[model samples]
Target: MAHLSLSWANVAIVLSLCLGSISYGYDFSIISTTVGQPTWYAYMGLTTDPTQASLYSYSNSIIGTIFGLFSAGAIFGGLFVGWFSDAHGRKKSLLSAAVINIVGGALQAGSVHVGMFIVARFITGFAAAMLVALVPVYIAEVAPPAIRGLLVGQHGAFFLVGYTVAAWVAVGSFYSANASFNWRFPLSLQALWPLLLCFFVYWLPESPRWLVSKGRPDEAWKILAKLHYDPKDPEQLFAREEFFQITSQCAADKASYGDVSLLHLFTKPHLRKRTLVATLVMWASPANGAIVIYSNIVVLVAGLGFDSADSLLLSAGWITLACVGNFANAFYLDKLGRVRSMVIGYVGCIVFVIIEAAIVAEYGGTTNKAALSAGVAMLFGFITFYGGFVDTTIYVYCSEIFPTHVRAKGMGWSIAVFFLGNLPFLESSTTGYATIGWKYYLLFIILPALNVGLLIYFCPETKGLSLEEINGIFEDKVAVRLTNLTEEERRDLDSRILDGVVGKDPQAQAPERNNVEKSAEVTLDE
Candidate 1:
């Protein structure tokens, strides 16, 4: 029942890294508002119907292209970071991505034509992808295992804040009435978050796990000391034990795998399973139509016969509720196992979206106020479940699944798959919403149901274990060395190898032992 207590330094790391996710959220959600604006349509010359002056009036193709291209750029950006972070380091990759976003944001705000704007959006998408890919990896590496889920859950919480702010900003922008400043000003705010990140991120500590992977254990040890050692603990027991595990594991992994290539992620049986599970986890998290729902929410609400002002307000409320859901996720993510929490989120989304679809099918464009209210409520419920149950767990699962040797690359592959996964959902939204209407949500419902099944079988529960000890889930019960140990030696080795200075909980130890036994049995059968 007790939550992990954080030191001030721990608070600073979580705040800094998690805050970086806000930029992506703001830029990503800001488009929802901008594209809904009449001024945005006019500025882009897509307002063909002057009679529909208050609406976007752009064709499905145009809307699809604008949204789809961002995913395309994100796919590219995600792949690039895998190699870049592994080659350089986590801190440098983040700073570089922030710089790229600044350039892209400037271009977006100052654009004179639609072509110019599209290119700028792609650049920004590219930059934002890097932040999404690397930030979770940084968080997972930096946080203590006891509280890792809570720390990583902050990524989703901060992301919802960005989405909420953008929705309200769009509501405020609507009052301006002037075509030029209305859309341009909101576009310009995208630059502010990355700029703040650039200034402060460089000064924070790099991931000690990453440093150890690069054969710089001395520097890694110093950082681990700073991060984990409390002067109040006279023995320095926890920090020393943790440091030893990290160094020992790095040595063991190097010996086992030799030099790591990305190919090893697929070539080794256990590593391949980790890679697949991690990538699939990323794909499933967003499968519940989060991007589709949020991106086109204003248009969907308007299509339900609400006025532009009311639609914007309604979308803002829906997103605000989602923000609250994410905060709840941050609090209880550690208490609920990752597999259970994610299942709850996915199932919640499926139920809500099905209800929304039914209501919209029955009552859309009608004067049935009750049906309209229910539909709006259903959409809000969808986001609430999506943000809390699904979105919150994606990064935490993906980041924790990989060892340090392949951590960044592993994260990149998963995120790249994430963006690529978005392509089908995002591309379908504009045309699907314009044509099939509420039935469009059926797609979101079906895919996530399948994902839930996939997770139930493959995803391991990763609560309350150190990063080093987590490898036991994948490693052999016996070490891979040529020498054999006596029964007494084996028990001592198991205690040291499986549990560190902090004694293991029976609850955690039981599942972990099962995981190791199951993995070894499976390998033997193979």
Candidate 2:
């Protein structure tokens, strides 16, 4: 329980990182509400059929392109994260992404034509995707090992907070008489997050792990010391030994890597397995086709005989439930571990999505409130499971599994695959929902069933391991951790362990000599 406690430093780092997540959530959810608004359609100059009750008549293809192109831009952004974060470092990368988002948000708020709006969305999507990749890596690197998974999972919780805010803003703006200003205000608000990030992020400490990777151990040790223990406390000894281990591991890893390249991920056996696992988890993210369903939720609701405003409002509730689910996930992920919790969510999504599709196919065209209410409930249930497990755990697994030398690249490629997987769903969602209807959801149901199987078989459990310790899994050694030690005992053991491992003092290794020799032999055999 003591290991799980959050210090002020931990809270500060986590809250600061959440700015990027909030920014992404706001932009992602606002569109669902905005696109359904009369003011938004009127401002965009979409044509309407005179006899139709709804004023907007944009084709499904047009809507799909508008949404899908954002996914396209995100793919480009994710591709850039590996090089950018590796070359410029994490802080600079995040600062650069903030500037890009500000420019895009400004353009989107002021867009006067469809083309301008489309371009702005692409730019914003690109920025958002980079932030998505950057924030988790930063958090994963800085977090204390005991709570690393919990902190990494916060990305989704905070993102859902932003989603909830956007939904309410869109609903509030529905009554505005000024069509242009109604949609404009929500888009403009996207600037607030990045602005906050840019101004405050500099005050935070750079990742000590990154400092170690760059051969600056003095700075790395100082930062790690400040983050973990009081100057006079016995716990400082553990922090010092931890620094020694990190530097040793980084030097070894650097030698092993030689010249790092993207191809090396596929060519190297252990890294390749790690890469494959990361990629599959990301591919599983959209296995339920949740993103496609969410993007078109407002429109889909309207098509079910609900009014536009009501549809937007109902969509808001779905996001609120998602926020709750995400928070619940952050609480339980460490306890349940990554794979089991995610499987629970996927299983729930599989059941609810099937039920929802059947309801929509049979009763979507009519005005049966009971059926429609049940359908909405099922969609909410799907998101509850999705936001709780898949949204957060996928990023956690991707971030924790990669070595520090290639972490950004590993996560970057995973996110690229994430956006890539979404492309087909995004491109087809609008048209599929209109033409094939709920049968489109059959693809979603089938894919997640398969994904659940893959997750059970392939996904590794990574709840409590340090970033460096995870390497043991690929090398076929058991994970070693000090989490079970009382703080006082850990402080005492750290001194002796450091003497044996770093000082080569055989006397200090007496207590665990046999265990250490066995582990070494196994590691060497690989």
Candidate 3:
């Protein structure tokens, strides 16, 4: 991996953006917990209980609409973010997501009818997906290569936190004395992260890469210095090298792709490959049983004969386990590398989901405590492992691959695919469990099984490279092996690149692809 100092400037940015991620979680997932509550039943006029104290059986379509519409809106939000973030700028796009989130959150809290609630779900989904999709792009831009996964994956970790909050809020709403306050308060909680984002919007530094692409190298340089600063080195060697690399590569990118278009993703062969990688990764994002567990586990546990209250609480614990897994992902993600971790996550999901389906098939609707206990235990274990391997894998991997020119758009399109992917799971869950029972999970087994093959073929390892350097991988060009170089070697290489005209200018044409990869291969193995 490339060497860059992990400094306080970078840490602060990670912490701040975590709030946006948590907010994204609230809307992305809270629907699961929200719809489970009795107050929600009464509030939506599904139950006649005036005090909003009883739950009722809403048809599959209604429940599906609640979950499906949010994702439907999320698909639009993720697609819009590409143009919105690029045309308006990162900071403004973030603010736009926050403000819109607030409107959706507020309306959800005040919704008087199911129609109003459904509309709010769509509106809320739009902003939440926007926030989650863009946070990785911003974080990846500012992060040092050494700890890039740790920072970029924060949204996934804290997103689990938001989901955990939803679980707890659902538990609390179940017991609240006031009916309206119970569901209303929990629904309104979706605004917390966005509200904090609105308050702190001024504090966000613009993405340095976004700045450079928009023709402001000076600002990008300062942001890089502040983020990757090293007090011990007065020369700011690593930081300076990064600036040169970013500006040089971005210039090359501009020269190559004039006026980047969304169509370029499919039309240009190089970008088409990159697009295929991102789409495949994201298309599989909602593929496995992970989303099924997130959205419908409480219902599953309830089927195991745990009453509504205990079911919600256990679901909360399950989300907490997922959060722990996300933390674990940050610690070792770069070490395992994205492709391996992703494969492991998918394969692991296959094993545990198979066990869970069998358990649900045999023990569901029964008071067989021991079998139910085993079933629940397997489900929880599956989530923890799933979280560790997959939570941030798709977003971090996809965001890191694209050049600055279409990064936002690529991510937007990628995230949109993710939400669109959710439609299948949500739509199926609505009717599958009621009709096929455990067989629905059997359908999930196939996608991840297929994805393992797709991932190994389409994705390349990008563990230790700057965003600028990542360009070479897709183009079959190896620009630089900055990670394997020692400090003095890097300084010397930096000097060589600076005295440009004597050789192939690093700014104009990158070094030949095969030579650098062959050399770096030996160093990487060691």
Residue 358, candidate 1: Cα error in Å is 0.7
Better lDDT candidate (1, 2): 2
Tens-place lDDT per residue, model 2, 160-237, is 888899888988887788777688998899899999999878987888778767656666766766677654455455
Which ranking of candidates, highest lDDT first?
A: 3, 2, 1
Candidate 2 — what's its lDDT?
A: 0.79
**How far off is residue 151 in model 3, in Å?**
1.1
Can you tell me which runs of candidate 1 are displaced by over 4 Å? Answer: 1-5, 48-58, 476-526
lDDT of 3 by residue, 199-281 (tens): 77788789988887776666776787788778786656667677666765665665566567888989999999999999999
- Per-residue CA lDDT of model 1 for 89-196, tens digit only, reads 999999999999888888888999888888888998898889988888898887877788888888878888888988998899888957788888888888899899
Backbone clash total for model 2 is 0
- Computed on alpha carbons, the lDDT of every model, listed in order, comes to 0.78, 0.79, 0.80
lDDT of 1 at 523: 55
Candidate number that wins on lDDT, 2 or 3: 3
How many clashes (backbone N, Cα, C below 3 Å) per candidate? 0, 0, 0
